[model samples]
Target: MLSKRVVSCFDVRDGKLVKSVKFVNTKEIGEVVGRARQYYEDGLDELVMYDITASSDHRDIMLETVEAVASEIFIPFSVGGGIRSVEDATDLRWAGAEKINVNTAAVDRPELISEISHAVGAQSTILSIDVLRVPGGPLPSGFEIVTHGGRTHTGIDAIEWAREGERRGAGEIVVNSIDADGTCDGYDVELTRTVVDAVGIPVIASGGAGKPEHLYDVLTEGGADAALVASMVHYGEYTVSELKQYLHERGVKVRMHY
Candidate 1:
């Protein structure tokens, strides 16, 4: 069986780690590199760093910050935001990101997904789908895709978009639930399951991981390959090791130690 992964997520704005509820009222958590290094030492399975405002500001990723965080970790690291072209993705790869996440840019130009995947291989490209729930419209699921740091709502169906992203060559999809974001209620299993069932690539459930059970549900019932944790882990309520142990005791497969 494939061992489930526990991913640590950091949302950086102006090079500082911050937390938001429903994608607003942001507050700084700490220095990005320091927090990332701490997570690495605490035995996180992987780390995902996002320049939250890059696309909104129409700028490139913070390579300086990326390099700083990458130098302090020994595990697979992925970075996203403001990746507009193959050249941008290449710069991030050279800066130490094993994978590149494309959201806004890919949404604007779907071909960029294929182009980046072709240049860096599909395994190095990830589709970060930040979505929010909406009333029934074009999508039967009523979940629309949001972009530009959850500020722009694209009338794209989450399920159909996931399938298209897979076809376009996104190696993995991180389905973030804007509705449950930072609420600490739990993951949106239905939202996650929708994408998981629609796509062949690995899906990582993001937004609203409050406890170990939440992670377990997403990985098992939701059919997700991994869970992206933020507030729960960010505020020191639980460590990655403890959460993994909790899941392991409950019969979930996970990496126990470095």
Candidate 2:
């Protein structure tokens, strides 16, 4: 197995960093550029930035802000939200985003995933899924896709969508749990495992990251290639290096030489 990744997430709204629980009640936490640079200097393996309200507000992504933040970091990071076409993905890439993450747009038009992936190699295209468990659903796994920033449930089985994403050329999948967002309890292991099992590409387990133990659990038992953390680092509770060191001590392979 490859070394597990410690990915930091920055949920941005109006060019500021924000955090929310269960995808609601969001509040600004910091400036996007400063925080991105801090995490990069602290040696985070990767970063994921979402323009949290772009889709819900029916607006384009914050390109200038994306460029400013991108200029501050050197590692691979994804820019998401309101990306509706290959043109948008190209713009994001030009703005310095290493990858493009599609959630609501990809759901509304599944073909967008392949279109962007075809335009800019599959490795640069990612499918970001906001998912939740719906009891008595068609999926035996019980996880369904939620869009519009988790406001609308699509009833689409997450497992199946992840499989389809891989077939359509998505190089990676980030499975974010609505039940766990900002809860900081832990990632939804079952939800992550289901997608990991169904997809051939890397699966990043997002949401509900409380501490290093949580990262370890998701990367090992949850079968995720990486764990996306926010609150634990955003609130000054821990630094990226400290978390990676903790994971390393616990026998989880992490890129620790930096």
Q: Quick one: best lDDT, which candidate?
A: 2
lDDT of 1: 0.87
Candidate 2 regions with alpha-carbon error over 4 angstroms? 53-61
- Please report, in order, the local distance difference test score of every candidate based on alpha carbons: 0.87, 0.87
lDDT of 2 by residue, 1-258 (tens): 578889998888888899867667789889989988988888889999887764544234478787897777778989887788999899889988889999888899999999999999999999999998888867777888997657798989888899989999999999999888877889999888878888889999998999789998898889999999999999999999999999999999999877
The alpha-carbon deviation from the true structure for residue 88 of candidate 1, after best TM-score superposition, in angstroms, is: 1.1
Reference-based lDDT, residue 235, model 1 = 91
lDDT of 1 by residue, 66-140 (tens): 888888898998998778899989988998999999988888999999999999999999998888899757778
lDDT for position 169 in model 2: 91
Compared with the true structure, the alpha-carbon lDDT of candidate 2 equals 0.87
Candidate 1 is scored at a TM of 0.93
Error of 1 at 185 (Å): 0.5
Clashing pairs in 1: none
